[model samples]
Target: MARNPERRNALLDAAIEVLTDEGARGLTFRAVDARAGTPTGTASNYFADRDALLAQTATRVNERMVPDPEHVASLMAAEPSRELIVHLMRDLVRRMTAERSGYLAMLELRLEATRRPALREELNRTVREQYDGNLQFHLASGLPGDADAMRVLYLAMTGLLVEHFTLPEMLSDTPEALDELVAVTVERIFPAA
Candidate 1:
């Protein structure tokens, strides 16, 4: 039987919904099949196994979060603006908060990937892509181009985001707290300009 791309996408979408809504512990072939409105055997036929489904799901999540090559190139060509950087950071935080379950699912996948070499490799590749894209954006925005500086900025931004998700009060105490944090972080990282 021919594999339907539409069916595959439907399954993938359902997988994401299940993962986000129920976490990794709740994700199962049966649940996904039900969510996709497909036959019980269809998911297994398409995914072969849970690991395969997870790997594909991780790839999909990364693709959705990070900018693509063309988008990155365009960002690199544009003039660096603090407003743009802050907006990006704010949007990422908002998305993370809104998709809390999805973020938790990704964290679970990261833990599982530690014991699975193939999954680990796929995650590492995604991380590299994210780092590269972020580096390009930071550089284009006139931040220091040194790897160390970029790493520090990335780490700080990630830490802030984690806090934003886990401790919403820390950021939501005031309307401008997140913006202030971003501004401070940016100025500290790119002091010269």
Candidate 2:
């Protein structure tokens, strides 16, 4: 395995692009090397095998999608109310949409997980951990939502993101429309505090 963390990150980022553009079937060491503009076999030097590459790529996608720490702190500083939930949801949507390739790569990972048990386990662990962390944060911050509300909000927001990414034409892509969607989702999920 390569000891250069930067080069390894570059390979993982390239893997993300390859996953987004070519889907899991086309994810290969050669493809990642080509995408990274590194010499042939470069990816192989860093990753043990395709499964290793795929698993690490899933981690990379989550890393790319992590929200800015300062932004999250600022949002948490505000009083926990339904409006605050709106702000948080909007921020999530913005981050996920802005990192479109990462999200698409994740979707590719989900499809690939259906066929690969190891990848499926990896994906499940990461996704569940993320959900638990978010739920914990919401509860600790005194956000006006129970676990059920959080669950419903998760489903609604995920549906919005999927529709936005997969069929942009189906939903109005305007910022105002998106903001409204987030606002409405929060209102419906949390009720008036």
Candidate 3:
């Protein structure tokens, strides 16, 4: 049975708020209900289980943060220049930093998914899609089509994001340091002439 659009949107919005403010572990049907200003039973009626609710929330968050593959491809195709690449990296960092709570909640969801095989499979699929999308961009950028290099770049970007939020002090207290770090990482992945 299909859910009412208004209720579904409300639930997703509430889930994002609850997950960001309270962490994924803190998410509960009652909390979502209160956040949505809907009846307590509404969440259960829609989600059926905690895992289902989390899966939906993860999908929602990804939809907002990660650009669609087609859009990324178009950007890559339009200008494969180093300047554009650096701009993309900086933009990504700024966005992730601004949404630290959501980023943390995503990390929590990944950890929890590891313990659940079904969730793990779904998470892995999503990751592969992201990887492919990134690889496509790199290929479009005239970079050497090295799968291993792309994988390394992807992992490094993920690590940098996690560290930026979880251990900002380690990177130093200056924006210059962050910019330098991004530049160095970009050069390593796509060396400048």
Candidate 4:
């Protein structure tokens, strides 16, 4: 891998755009180069293979989507109460809605991972790392839940986010209704205090 960090990031962003718009099958070095408006073969200069390109694209999408530590800490400042959890869920879903393209790219990566062992291994590792990190954060913050609770919360949030981003009206009539849905989901999963 050539280490042109700036150029590599530009290529990764372009890859995400391609994935978001055309799905995994459409993600090609030439597509990325064209999307980035760079010279032909520019993406190939940085990526050794399609697997490497997809791996970097996934990493970049994850980086773009994760919230900053400070914001997460502020959200947790009120302690791990039901209401606080609901607010966090709302914010998370809202953030996913805003970053719909990135989320779509991630979905594309996940679907493509099913057929590529190397990509599957890497994506699985990344997913486990995120799950572990969330569990650790919950424990450190004194959240009232264990691994199973976290799993349920994770699934619930994933479902909510997918619905919000893909089929918004199915979840609610308006944005306020979506907030209520988040509140209800959190309350159900976390148990009211």
Per-residue alpha-carbon lDDT of candidate 3 for residues 33-80, written as tens digits (9 for 90 to 100): 999999878888888788888887777667667755675566566445
Cα lDDT tens digits, model 2, 39-153, are 9999999999999999999999999998888989988898888888999899998899899999999999999999999999999999999999999989888888789999999
Tens-place lDDT per residue, model 1, 41-100, is: 788888878888888888767755654567546545645655556556665666666666
Where does candidate 4 stray beyond 4 Å?
Answer: none
Ordered from best to worst lDDT, the candidate numbers read 2, 4, 3, 1
Give the top-scoring candidate (lDDT): 2
Backbone clash pairs in model 4 (N, Cα, C under 3 Å; residues 3+ apart or in different chains), count: 0
Model 2, residue 150: distance off in Å is 0.5
TM-score of every candidate relative to the true structure: 0.78, 0.97, 0.84, 0.95
Better of 2 and 4 by lDDT: 2
Task: Sort the predicted structures by TM-score, highest score first.
Answer: 2, 4, 3, 1
lDDT of 4: 0.88
Q: What is the lDDT of residue 116 in candidate 1?
A: 82
Question: After best superposition, candidate 1 residue 151: deviation in angstroms?
Answer: 1.1
The per-model lDDT (C-alpha) reads 0.73, 0.92, 0.76, 0.88
Native-referenced Cα lDDT, model 1: 0.73
**Model 1: per-residue Cα lDDT at residue 16:** 81
* Model 2: residue 54 alpha-carbon error in angstroms: 0.5
- Alpha-carbon deviation at 148 in model 4, angstroms: 1.2
| RMSD (CA, Å), each prediction | 3.2, 0.9, 2.7, 1.2
